[model samples]
Structures are given as structure tokens and as C-alpha cells.
Target: MGGRILVADSVATNRIALAAILKRGRYNVSMCSTASDALQMARAAPPDLVFSASELPDMPGTRLTERLKAQTGMRDVPVLLMSRDREAGDVVSALAAGAEDVMPQPFNELALMARTRSLMRARETDRALEQHQSTVRCLGFSEQAPDFAPAARIALVAESRARGIALAAQLKREISQPVATLDLTGALAEADSAAPPDVYVIDATLEAPGDGLRLLADLRSRPGTRHAAIVIITDADNSMAVANALDLGANDLLLVGFQPQELALRLKNQLARKRRADLLRASVEDSMRLAVIDPLTGLYNRRYAYAHIAQIDELARKTGRQYAVMLADIDRFKAINDTWGHAAGDAVLAEVAKRLRDNLRGIDMVARIGGEEFLMALPKTSDIDARMAAERLCALIARDPVRLPGSDQSTAVTISIGLAMSGAKGRLSLPVNTLIDKADRALYCAKAEGRNQVTVSRTAA
Candidate 1:
């Protein structure tokens, strides 16, 4: 079975009809006669999605959807409203009230199942992102407030420039934002730009038949534009176009000519969705960063250092360039730890990290891989420049005294650097781990020769 589904309707025949269609698709279908029963059954064992008629004996499907969303755990479950032919206004209201979609009966099987699969796929994605729910909540991203009057970027693609301009002007009165009229030639290029549209409104009858649908596919193919909201506008009688558009990755659709107020409402809903997805993406990125970054010193951690070294090695191999690796260890770090508390030792580490990070080029990466030890990668650097950089870092640490947070005392510190380079000629065949090992060996050699100095590995020269 694809997923569990609950069908809620007042009439038995109506319930059975929808259930049979879902069952044909191998979904686990559960039937309920009233909205009250539907809620109880859903709370007992929540289904992946719900198909409820617009009117029930006790309540409307919109009310049922609202009730389900009220619960903390069931908020993500999708609800599709089934509206009779006479209920066009109700269908619009239901969608605005938060139903995933409203299908007018007799439902088009393709659109229904396509919508089902789409919603289910979204549900699964949300479920996966829930793994970071705790961290997202800690960052205050879990609770997002909707903007009352939405201002968003809109992309309008129509058959003619006049119709597109007219639509843009009509929309501009209701909401304040840039509504770009796009031709097919400039569509993909604009999508690649830094600020792509927030919502794309494309006319179904374009310069030629099916061009609008083709454009939707093109937009989704690009990584940067895939997440942008797409709304299709088509003629009233072309029911098949609506279905095709939905199945072809259009996020929302409207039939007939333009109405400004309804257009505003639909665009606002899309903007809200776009903002929410952006927030979730950002939260996941933050968690991923936290995993590989040292919270105290704000430097890359050991795990990131190892992976980064490999990436640099691959890039060097492809480009026929040399990369430098350096291991830095603070001299007599234990004495500082013993003389002052761990907090002062932490202060010293932070100071050293700042100096090393600020002095280097953007192409360099530095990580704290051990207690009082740091590792660095400098890509495409010559042996002389690498040695000069290592010596400069040593001097920066010894130049200043790191002050304690509370006490009026200061601690002086210096670092010893061990330098190794992937020989500029045969760097492609060299293993990154060997470079790291060579750097470690030279780091120890520097400590032996005396603390607070720099040493270069023999293999590097």
C-alpha cells in the first residue's frame, strides 16, 4: 500500500466511491460517515491523508481540517476537500481556509491520485526534516508567523506581452512587489539570477500549445528555481490542462480570466509556503554547521578538517596544483591550564584561533583537531609562501598577550608550527593522510628543536 487514507462523507455511496478509487491505487482506505467520526478515527490512528466531502452531517470538511490541524501531532497530515459542482465559492473558501486542495466531483482520477502522491511525498519530506525539530525549535524556527499583507516577487509568463502587463498591473494594486513579465527566451536566465521570483504565474495557452507546461518543466530542472512556487492560469473549459499542469509540477492553478482579489489571496498562500520551506532549509543548514564547528572557539572541528583535506586533495589533483598542510601546537599548554583555570585556557585558544583565521587567505581552512592543536590547509600555495605563512602565524601568536575574562591578569603564549606540502609536481597521486602525517611529524620536530618556532618537513622541499 502507498499510504493510509481516511474518506469522510455523509452519504454511504459517496464514501464507497472515493474509497474504491483509493483502494484501486493500493492505498489503505478507511471510511467514516460524519466529520465527528472522522476526527475520532484520525486521532486514534492517524492516516497519511484525508479525503472529506465539503459538507458532512455535523460539519464541513474545512472545519474538520481545521480541527485536525489544531492538534500538535496531526498538523502535518493533508486534507483534500471534495466539493459538488454547485459549490464553486465553497471550494475557494475551503482552499483559503487551509485545505491542501479541493476536487470538484466527479473527481478526475488522474488529478486526484497525482495530488495524493504529491501530498504524500511532501508529508514524507516533512517527516524526515522532523529529525531536526528539537534543534529548529531551539533556534525559534519551529513557530513561524504569517504576514498579513504579503509582499512577494511574482513572475508572469503569458501568450502576449499586453496580457502579461495587464495582469501585472492588476496585481500590483493589491500587493506591493516586483511582477516581472517574462518571455520564454529570458525565463531560464532570470531563474538563474540571484533573486528569482517567489511565485510564477504562467498562462496555459502560451505562444504555442503546451509551451507553458514545457516552461514549468524547465524551471524545475534547475536547482536554484526548483523551490519557487508555480501557479498556472488556463481557460475555464480546459479541464485537462489543469490536470496536466498539476501533474507537471505546477503548485497551484486558476481557471477563466483574471480576478485581482482572488489572485492576491492565492499568491499570498504560495508566498507563505515559500517562506516556511526557506526557514526549514536554513534550520537544517544551521544544524549541519553546528555539527562540524567548535562552539567555543568558532573554528572548524576535527571531522570537518579531515573531509576538507580530501576535497582539497581532489581539487589539487584535477588542477595540477600543490596544497600546504600545517599542524600548530601551543607550547607548554598544560602549564597554562595548571596556572589558570580551564576558562582562561579557553580564552587563550579563542585568541589563537582568531589570529590564525584573520591572517590567512579565503582559500585556506583551519581546524582545531586536538587539545591545544590546530590543523590548516592552504590550497595552490608554493613551498616558500607556505613556509612564510607558517612563520607569520607563529609570530602572531607570540606577539600579543591574551587577557582573562574577569581577572586583571594576562597570559603570554606562543605556538609551534609543523609544515608539509603536497610536492607541486606529483600532488595528484599523493594521499592527504600522508600530508597530515608529515605535518604532524614536523610539528613534533619543531617542539624538539625548541618551542615557539616553525619547521618544514623534508619531503615538502
Candidate 2:
């Protein structure tokens, strides 16, 4: 079926014209002569796109837009405004009132078609996004959480056959998805063809040879099922079952013998809590990601680099070991910006940052401190190791020519690096800033000697 469209206009002629155009395009069209009628139709069943005239018989188009947006389910629907006035302020006002697009009087066929197509595409995209988000939220993964694809299979484990049947009924009634229930004693191995349940609920009691607790323990031990959210249903109010369940890695515990409302509430609450935990985890990951990441180049930022160095320094002091820091700078970066463009300069910086990150070990931290400057913290590394790492990074960057995006042109980017180490058994007392300064001084010496080389900081006497 073609896309659905709602066309609202005060004049019958304009409505007829738009309906004809939409019909020619094989779209399902609904016509309303007033804002009130349009709103009624929209509430009855939302359309893919709404086109309303600026002046409606009952209310202004802007007011209608606001009202439509205020209503649940209709807020995300796109509203396009049509006006006879060509004034910029009028267009701006309509947009501010939540109209996704506006077309002045004497709408050209081409412009109308283009605007209609764009708004429809945007609305479809938004619909897909909302549906995906809803699925994620249902499964206890919020927008902030890591990417969790929708589950194709669902599993429920209950000891009582009657209770299992009832729970399955409730799931089917509450959620518009397929769900399968299994006796806690049933072998999970049997469900190998079906994808593992994204969520697993285990009843505390089992009619099987062994109790459900054993099954829960067995599932927890299996590496494949370790990440699944496990909800344990129990009648046991004592601390032992709860503690044991938690110790066995159950994500939640649901008490049985409650009213249906209570059971549903508990289920919903557990799901929400799981989603919240996932969101928090994602937030922490994103924070950690940003902590070391330079926004422009996607490299680690200075704060993380400093913290990494501090950690290494502490470890080295305790173990009578040594580590090194490398400070690097781009030579004549300003000249490139002046001659080519800030875009070209940015390209060069990004390339350099990529090279630095690529050359470092996974445990090593590479951070961009400022414009054209970077720092690397290497743990369990000596001065010589640091020098070698820096030299390797410099050589790699110097060898590669950075090709600017959207352009055929390539530019040479070179880096000068400085290395410094904390002496072993001397208990390096230098602060993070001091260590960076020592590395920076060496970097300056390298730059002075000649660009694109690595220099070591003078060893402490």
C-alpha cells in the first residue's frame, strides 16, 4: 500500500488539488476542511504526513501543530504547513510551531513533490528508530546502553506446569511477541537450534530430580549463558535463597504467590531495572571512551593519558620498575593551516592521531593534549623502549601521506617525539604535570635538533 497522507485546507479547491496529486502518486489521502476535523482524524489513526493550511476554519495551523505534538502517539508525526504568504517570518513561525516543512502559496509541483518526499522519508526513518528504541527498552536496554539487537527467541523456566502455562499466557497477553516456556529440568541443550533467550527466568522450585537452584548454578557456569539476564522466582523469603541466587549470578529475584497485578508489577520492575543497569553500563563505557578520546581525532584525551601515567608511575614505584612517557608535536602545523585550510590541517591532525593510536599497545594510552600535540603513557616500559616506540610512531606518520577527505590532494605530516622515564629504585616523586613537562622539554629539543625525530629526556643524576 502507498503511504498515508492527511491534507487539511480551508479551501475546497486546494484540498482537491492536493488529493489529486497524492492520488496520482498512489498515496492514501484523507481530507479535512478544518483543524478540528483534522485533529479528530489524526487521533483516530495517524497518517504518514500531515499537510495543513496556515489558516484553518476552526483554528490556526500553528495551534493545530502544537496540539498534535502535545498528544501522545502523534507527537512524532510530521506536520507540513502551507501558506499563501511568502514572508520569511511566516515560514519561520510555522517551523517554530513544530511544522517539519513549510511551502508558500503557488506551490510548484516540483517543490511540493520534493518536500512531500523528504518529509515522508524522514517520518518513516523516525518511525523505524522509535520502534527499534521501543524494542530495546522492552528488553532492558535503553538508548544509552550498548547495541543490543532485538531477540528472536524468548525462554521462561518454571517448575510448576500450571504456573509455567499461566506465565506464558501473561507474557503473550502483555507483550506482542512469541514466548516459550520450559520446565526448569528440561535440558537447555535441546533448544540449541533456537537462539538462546535474551532473558531467562528461573523458578526456585523444581519437580525434577534436582532442584531449580542447581539448574541456575549450572546455567551460570556455562560461558554461553553467562551474559543473559536471569530472573529467579522464589517463594523463599529467607536470606539464604536470595543470597545464593545472587551469588549464582541471577540478575533479579521475583517472589511467587502474589496477585497477578503484583506479579506483573514485579516483572515490569525487573525489566526496567535491567534496562537501567544496561544504560548505566553503557554510560560508563561512553565516559571511559570519552575520557581517553580526543573529540576531533577520536584518540585518547589528555586527562586519561595523565591518569594512566599516574597509575603506571604508582605501580613502578612499588615494584621497583620503570615506565616512560612520550610527548609529540606536529612540525609547522600552523603553516599548513595558513596555506591550505583549517580543514586540511584537521585532516593532518586526525591522520597523525590515528597513527599514534595504531602504533601503541592496547594497554598503552595515547592522548591528544592540544592543537597538534599528543602524549602517550607506556607502562612497564624503559627509556629505550619509549624511544623505540616514539621513533616508530614518527617514522610511520612521516611515511604515510594524509589524503584529505573529498579531495584528491595528499599532504605530508611528520611528528617530533620526546621520551622520558622514571628511574627505578629511586622512587620517582614527580607529579603527572612534571613528567609531561620533562617529555615536552625533550620534544622541544628534538624539534630544535631537526623535525620528525625522537629525543630522550636527560636521566636524573
Candidate 3:
């Protein structure tokens, strides 16, 4: 994926080199020689990724990472630290300081490009999710709390049982999260589980060469584990495998074998990233549900009903099939609210919604379009069938009284329904709004003729 990257290095040659490589990969590259300049540039407009040398003129690269992360909009922008022959302690410190990874200098082109692609893809996804979440919050829904970090579940998969067990034990000691050891088959089985591992540490060459890469692809494809973070461990000499692992959706990689602390820190970062993604997905789902559903009666609202009617209309036009639309109103609903209070009216509305929803065919659509007013549609229905259905609905509501909130007493309730049909012989198809208006006129006829009855629209107009 193409993205903007900020490259900060004191050495002119190093900045040029990195920029050339990134530009070759189709990334827009910006450069700065000092940490202060990089900070200023980034604050003005955050890049998709940042590549900073561990040694900066004014401040250390890790400090730059810390500062960028502390910035409000820049927190999710990943930072990659370039280290030349850096010690293990330095790598650990950089990671702990929130750098995405510490890349070795005189970079391996294949590994560098693959890692860059991986980072860019993840950053793009994060940005899209954040944009959706922001839209949701703008619709008056609360955003998920950032500080909530649930305990992560980690899985250790190795070529051998002993190796897997040993690594699991080591990981258990380094982190407080639950750890489990699984072989290739066991890991595959996790794809069927409801709560699979939040992260999987897979040793390359499980049963044969590149087995772990296959597993990574499989886990990423499965719905249950598709969003789970995966880290692949490979030999330092196997740069091709490292590149392949990242290309196949491995979240991170471990070369020169795994150190418990380093793996733990990497796992922590992956877990936190996955949590943010999961919460954002949940928030989007909640917001979408709220947008289309009526909170009062737990039924679809006017907005959704209109869209659904359009769909039904289109389908009827294509298939030349008959469909029914009905406008239902609770008779004398205002008097109930005035006499017993809005609470009793709410109770009655809820009961009526439930009755309508339960009694209708599974393919039928029912929604509360307004207070004391509902919209129902039945596809592939005849006028005779529609009239019978409407009569049944009127009887269903008037058959028994609805019990009031927190009271033993009950009040009698009735509904008047107006029915209109599509696909009448020699008649042209009507627009959805026009059909609704016809149903409304029929409803007026029903209310005028009697309080509790069904009225079918006969005139084409």
C-alpha cells in the first residue's frame, strides 16, 4: 500500500538511502536531519509511518518515538528505529519506548520492503477504523474508553511438543496473560473456536519448511482468528522466510531466535493494537444498530422502513410478484397516555410491536414509523391474503387487554390497518412514497369507517 513516511536521520547519506528505498516501494518520503525538525514536521501533518535513526542530533530516536506517541493525533503512527550494530539492550529499549521495530542498518532490501508493506497496511487499516469511529461518535454515541485493556490470550506453536511447552513456560514467566502450547493441528483447530488466542507465536518450519507461513495464511483467512495478531519466529539467516511471514499477514517477526522480554514487549504492543481494533469494530456495530432501530419498542425505525420498502418495490417490479404494504395505527393511543400516563402507552406499544413481529411471516417486514404508527410489508402476497392477514392482526390486538406498567389492572387496545397491494393487473408500478401515501389514505378510511377494522385501497390513485 502507498503511504507517506517521515525519515529522520542526522546522516545525509542514510536519509537519502532510506528515502530512495521507500520511494521505490511507492511511498511518499519526507526527510529531516534533526529530531526537533522531524517533530515539527510530523506535528504539522502526521505521516503514515516514521523512520528515525537511533542517533539524532538533538534527541534520541526513542525519545522522538515517545514524543510522537504522546501527541494526540500521532499516537497510532508507527515509528521504525534504524540501528547500526545496536546491542540487544538497545533493541529492547527502543521497543519498550514504543518504536514499532528496530531495523538493522545496511538493510536487507527484501526484508525492509516487506516490513514496510506490513507497517503501511496496518497503519491504513487503523486510520480507516478511526475515521469510522469518529463518525459514529459524531452521531451521539459514546466512544470506547482507551484505557480499557483486557487480558490477552497468547498461543505458542512450535514444531515439537517439547519446544512449544518450553516456550510457553518461558512466556508465562515473562507475562501475566494466559499462555497455551498448541501444535499445528491444535492451532488449526483453534480456528473453529469462539474465543481463540488473541496472539499466536508460531515457530517457522513447524512440520516442514514454511509450515508456519501456511498456518499464518490460514489463521488470517478464518473468521474466528482473522483479526488475531500473529508473530513468526525464524532463523536469522532465513530472510526470505521472514519476508514471506510478513507478506502472509504475520503482525511481527522474531529473528536470531526469541528473547522472552523482547517477545513479551512485542506481544504487549500487538495485544494493545488488536484491542483498539476490536473496540472500534464493536463501536461501529453499535452505532449502525442504533441508527436503524427504534429504541423505544426494539423494532426498526422510519429510516430503515423506507429503505426496505424500496427494496421490496424493486424486487416486485423485476419478478412481477404481488406484495402488500400496510399502515397500522394503535386506536385511541393518545387517550391511554393521557389517562394512565406515557408509561402505560409505552407498555402498550411494546406489546403491540411484539405481537406484530411474532405473528408476521419470517420474510415480512415490520417497523414503527411513528408514535402509535407502524409500517408492515409482505412480499409475494395476494390482495385476498393481505386482507385476511390484516383482519387477523386487528383481532390479535383486540383479543386481549394489555397490562399496564407495575399494575394488575389492564386496558383494552385495538388497531386499525390500511392495506395496499403492488402488481395489480394492468396497473403501473408506483413509487415507494406514493404507495405509502395510498396506504395512508386507506388508513384514514379505516379510522373513519370504524375504530378497529381493516380497509383495502381499491382505486388506482
Q: What local distance difference test score does each model get?
A: 0.81, 0.70, 0.86
By descending TM-score, how would the candidates be arranged?
3, 1, 2
Clashing pairs in 2: 140-275, 292-300, 292-301, 294-299
lDDT of 2 at 435: 77
* TM-score of each prediction: 0.59, 0.41, 0.64
Once superposed on the true structure, which residue ranges of model 1 sit more than 4 Å away at CA?
86-88, 134-151, 235-240, 290-461
* For model 1, the run of ten residues with the poorest summed lDDT: 131-140
Which candidate, 2 or 3, has the higher TM-score? 3
Q: Which numbered prediction scores highest in lDDT against the true structure?
A: 3
lDDT of 2 by residue, 355-389 (tens): 78887875576778889998887766666667778
| Candidate 1 lDDT score at position 372 | 93
Model 3 weakest 10-residue run by lDDT = 130-139
Residue 428 lDDT in candidate 3? 38
Model 3: per-residue lDDT, tens digit, 91-196? 7898999998889898988999999999988986776566545545655664556685777889999989999888888888888999999999999997778889
lDDT of 1 by residue, 1-461 (tens): 56679999988898888888888988889999999999898888778899898889998788888998786668778788887762556655776667766777887777677677777766655553553444345444355534454456789997899988988899899877778998877777789998788889988778799999999988988887898899988764566777678778887877664467667777877787677666677665565476767877888888767866776776567546688999999999899999998999999999999999999975588899979999999876888999999999999899989998799999999999999989675546768888899999999999999989999999887
Q: lDDT score, residue 100, model 3?
A: 85
